[model samples]
Target chain A: MKLKEIAHSRTGDKGNISNISLIVYDQKNYDLILEKVTPERVKAWFSESVFGEVIRYELPNLGALNFVMYDALSGGVTRSLSVDKHGKSFSSALLEMEI
Target chain B: MKKIRIGAGAGYGGDRIEPAIELMEKGDLNYIIFECLAERTIAIAQEEKLKDPTKGYNGLLEYRMRKVLPLCKEKGIKVVTNMGAANPESAVRVILNLAEELNIKGLKVAAVLGDDISQSIENYMHLEVLELKNPLESIREKIVSANVYLGIEGIVEALENGADIVVTGRCADPALVLAPLVHEFGWSESQLDLRGCGILAGHLLECAGQITGGYFADPGYKEVPDLWKLGFPIAEVSETGDILIEKVDGSGGLITTATCTEQLLYEIHDPSTYITPDGIADYTAITMEQVAKDKVCIKGGKGRVRPETLKVSIGYKDSFIGEGEMSYGGSNALAKAQLAAEIIRNRLPIIGCEVDELRIEYVGFNSLYGTKIGEVLNREHTLGEVRLRVSGRTKTRAMAQMIANEVEALYTNGPSGGGGAMQSVKEVVAIGSIFIPRSDIHVNITYKEV
Candidate 1:
């Protein structure tokens, strides 16, 4: 129901890479969500839209999932012109997941 | 024979330059360049312009300018800067007036305009040629500040037009040095490698003699001799696109391989794809050697083709944020602060109030730099403070104001007893960029007599 709960539920301390907590809301099946929301499972869930490495972890304390996406941003945060730092249109892809 | 020295100071926020001024007086530097504009600064400038059009220009920080300009004028050193944000013409007008008041003669002022592209944003979006994926849909209604970052060509044009002081808005940091190179050498824009070299030169000097020492010097902050009188920065650009990063005589800060390498790596995310308005420069391609004491020679900087389109900054109204602070006096202050934040979050939503962002920071308990987290357990409370910050769009006024009121009331329930409350939440405006085709945006370089 809350963002912090979502973040806390999906946190993991992996080697060389730490899982950053993120919250994706589910308006319909908020209660039906399962416990085992691994990064690999989350990546497979959004496999169609995601281009980079999507690693997910479920935080038992907060009941949330955290994901660390690698190179998800086109050109790594900068476009052809280096002055701007806005990444490409990937938010819709990010917002479509069922959490 | 005395060397013609130049010092460039990176400008950001109004700070005193007594040390730099003192150096200029003693060193006899010929030119000084000051740079100050980050992406965040651009956002803030746009927000201000939306609130009041006349107040957005950064050059209006005349307090800092007043202190340095008169000193430079007296010492006969030329200065170039991009402090003119939003309205450069108005900024120049003020500076010229200041020149007159100072009784400084021959103050050649030049203005670089035509970068503002707010009107043509719609036309560019409709074309659909360059895909702007997740554009800020909400900002379309009230876009405030929009300025394209120009290149060194404008700076060169200003210098060729006989203007001594070139004031610009949102120009690339390296353009400060490249402009002088273009003016002196007449290098064409198509010379990508040469332009890249010039940009590299600008990047080196843009920090205002920073390469020589300011921030890259030894630990314990050993005082450079007569640093109180340190110069800005000046580049001796050669016809071959070679630049000598040097400072005025008798100035402090060492220019060595270590210092130069440190400065080159500053704020750089990717070494290979270092982008500038001019072109993409390869930092690895650069070769440096300490040829002399306090002198670093940089060469072999490679550049690639520049992108066709220009990026424009767009800002829109977002939300109102309210913050309140109270000093936690009793023991276990950190626990009290955390509990207070938890209480606010849990109770705010019950009263028809939603928060977008809630941050509870213990200033003394945590380190501000990098991502290091400090332990917040079992610490004696000598002097501690807890600040609560919350942001939200829906809770614009009444709801956001109530959050502030609640924070103050926490003194009875909060751990620190009754300390005080401060209002911190205000409107949150979001800023993004919309690239327009080269044809839509026009860059006009004009020369006017002063």
Candidate 2:
């Protein structure tokens, strides 16, 4: 199943760093998400677009995983020339990742 | 068991005001706090203050205060907002004047100042932009506003002094919520568990309707009802720091575990160590329970020691962005839009325009995901109509205008059947973050009666 199949996500940005959180609908899917959605995998998924590091933090009680993508917003919202400057759609883009 | 109900009025500087009014009227809230003034807003507000000192507060201050102040004053509901933007003193004066106009007597308004640290930043030996690692001296000439994020102390002081309305500048969002809890519950700064719980409650209510399913809806999958009349969030916080989340009765939207969980993790990078001015709150062990419809009970928050350094948001003149867009419809629309984007891409170099960055996107196809959607676009798809958007940023307004002009020329030059051509050129005030010692900043709270 894809990440979006059992989880929902939201995106927020600070400077060039974009933090995307993925919260699973059911607690049972936590292990699957933990195994499939690693920082290394997220970095690979974003590849060249992310200039800095990708860090993932887990909130086991809430069944959520937050991925902080550094240097991801091109150069942050006010400076970025991209249409979606805040990287708001990055969560949807990450949902496209197959499991 | 002393408990107070608080409502999150406005989330951003330009957020809808009607929902906040609804919250004030129906939520039975003791405090209605507006979390406006983001990093960039204060910078722009500072520019306004430089020209006319009294004009630095939020643009909607008068409209909102006039509508809600009398009602709030009558109901004994304390109003707290960071709408002061670059000037809390000016905001205080505006609220006081409004109170006089409404004939509302004995209104206590408090203005919390000292967040602005423009002079202090210059004294640092070699300041580096947090996360970005950029040198501070590079953009020093263009710095418009530099304000430190004040914590709950100033707000708590204001509330303790019996201020009916509190206005502040550049305060941490959660601090607005936590201050009331601290003032009401008499929670000391060392009560980590209690403070942590307060922080959690505040974070949930900080974004107004976001917790009540405004931004949580995903249509067929995660359905939310009556979003058009979605109600902002209200938190009934107990003296012990326990919280029950709900919305105004009969208002639109629903709150469940899904909505609560999504809000808990919003904008948070590290759940274990979420830093704020008051202390470091850990939501790692956080848990929530749905007790009833449109109500969630939140518990199990932990707090660590507060950081010695405070985060400062520095706003500087970035550049000017010029954008142009035109729509194409009927058969082969996507192709024509692509051709239109190509024309803008090629035109810039020929026109000798110096752009720091450039972006060309086919609106319906690849405007958001950029090249990442290449794999999906490779699959079978059909686009009946699409829009071509071209934008570029440059230091000079003339250069920015040239980029937009090139796209306006597309109506007659090429890409036949292009219509609704639009062009815009605007100045960009970018934000950078740095950490300064907490000792370097001092806050003072003053109150006025009307």
Supply DockQ values for each candidate. 0.03, 0.71
Model 1 achieves a DockQ score of: 0.03
Clashing pairs in 2: none
Tens digits of per-residue lDDT, candidate 2, B69-118, equal: 97787788998899999999999999998888889998889999999988
- Runs with alpha carbons beyond 4 Å of true place in candidate 1: A1-99, B1-5, B23-28, B42-55, B59-61, B64-76, B126-133, B136-138, B209-231, B246-256, B329-331, B365-372, B375-398, B417-421, B446-450
Top model number, TM-score: 2
> Per-residue alpha-carbon lDDT of model 1 for B177-240, expressed as tens digits?
7777667667676787877887787777765655666553323322354455445555666677
In candidate 2, residue B9 scores what lDDT?
91
Model 1's C-alpha root-mean-square deviation from the true structure amounts to 12.3
Q: What TM-score does chain B alone reach in each candidate, compared with the true chain B?
A: 0.82, 0.97
User: Which segments of model 2 are wrong by more than 4 Å?
Assistant: none
lDDT for every model?
Answer: 0.57, 0.87
TM-score of chain A of 2: 0.96
User: What is the lDDT for B139 in model 2?
Assistant: 81
